[model samples]
Target: MTLTFAEAGEQDIPDLTRVMTRAFDDESRTYRGLDKGGPEGYDNGDFFRQWMLGYDETTGYTILLDGEVVGGLIVWIIPGGHNHLGAIFVDPAVQDRGIGTQAWQFVERTYPGAKSWRLETPAWSLKNHAFYERKCGFTKIDETDSPDGVMFVYRKIIHPD
Candidate 1:
């Protein structure tokens, strides 16, 4: 399966937001019995536009499989190669196809300067916990409470040869 990560444009916001909502809502229903869940402003794409694409040190992209848009990703590059994965998600309709793993490999290749990476998933997202810890090779470092929910912090340190 081929994958592409194109830098997001203003026009992509609406669809990306839809993908985000769908991905999050799926997990919420499975894990929490709720119909809605995600980072703030995802309901209307405001978070994607204002923070994911607009903030300093942040870069957002649209994940394309073959030629169709499937998801979105955001990254933050800070000084000292201490980077952060702001978010990454594939549409629920096409999930479990290894797209997320492929996208993560693409992310690592894209950010060759990164010496470490960090991200957070909601405490209740068991699938996310496994994906990050088992598939992505990140270790749970801590947990913190946010307005959205309790979040588990995960980190991976890249060792150079």
Candidate 2:
């Protein structure tokens, strides 16, 4: 699938909410070992509200497949030319088609000056672990235990010459 990204705006909130909800529901269900509501007992609306409340348009992008919004990501370009992948999600229906990998490629090209990229994911999700390590060239840097669950931090150092 052809993938592109557009800057996320207030107008995209509803679509982003749906996409995020659909994309993460399975993980959320598997995460808590039951269909509680979301990854951490919160529903889609909770996630949407948090995103809307804390969103930064300058660092948010809606992932589009052939011009249709399919996913979204948030990245923070921090000081010292480093960056963080605040979040990235692809519609579960269209996953395993290399869209996430391509999205990361797009991000790398878009932020050519970035010296490194970092993100965190649920430690129980081995699929995510492999994707970040194998496909995205990230390394497991650390792990943290939180009230929600264990999270593994992944980091990829960019070598741009």
Candidate 3:
């Protein structure tokens, strides 16, 4: 399938909400300790969008597969040469298919001036840990437990020449 990154806009909220909510369904269930259903859920795009508004240097993109939205991401460019990966999610139905990897590569190339990359993920997400550490070349620098769950902070330094 052809994968592409499309700039996300305000009108894309419903689609983003649908894709990301489904994308994070498994993680939400795991975090909430619910096998069937629960109150607290994941992929609250409205909440995420509100949070992103606090960042001055953020960009959002929708992951499109064959012209269909399958996932989305938000990135913040730090002034001093660092790039923070605010969020990245692929539809759970389409996970493990390398769509996220390609999308990330596109982001990296799109922001070539970034000297480092930083992001955080839930400690409970073993698959995410593996993907970030192995496939994405990030190192888990630290992890801290919160009321919700443990958050793992990862970092990757881009080679400087």
Runs off by more than 4 Å, candidate 1: none
TM-score of each: 0.95, 0.85, 0.88
> Which model, 1 or 2, shows the larger TM-score?
1
Top candidate, metric TM-score: 1
Best by lDDT: 1
lDDT (CA) per prediction: 0.89, 0.78, 0.78
Model 2, span 53-86: residue lDDT tens: 4655337788899999998887878767667987
TM-score of 3: 0.88
Q: State candidate 2's TM-score.
A: 0.85
The predicted structure with the larger TM-score, 2 or 3, is 3
lDDT per residue for candidate 3 within 27-73, as digits (tens), equals: 66765565432113334556445644446688788898898899888
- Indicate whether candidate 1 or candidate 3 has the larger lDDT: 1
Worst 10-residue lDDT window for candidate 1 reads 47-56
Look at candidate 1 and tell me the lDDT of residue 9.
Answer: 76
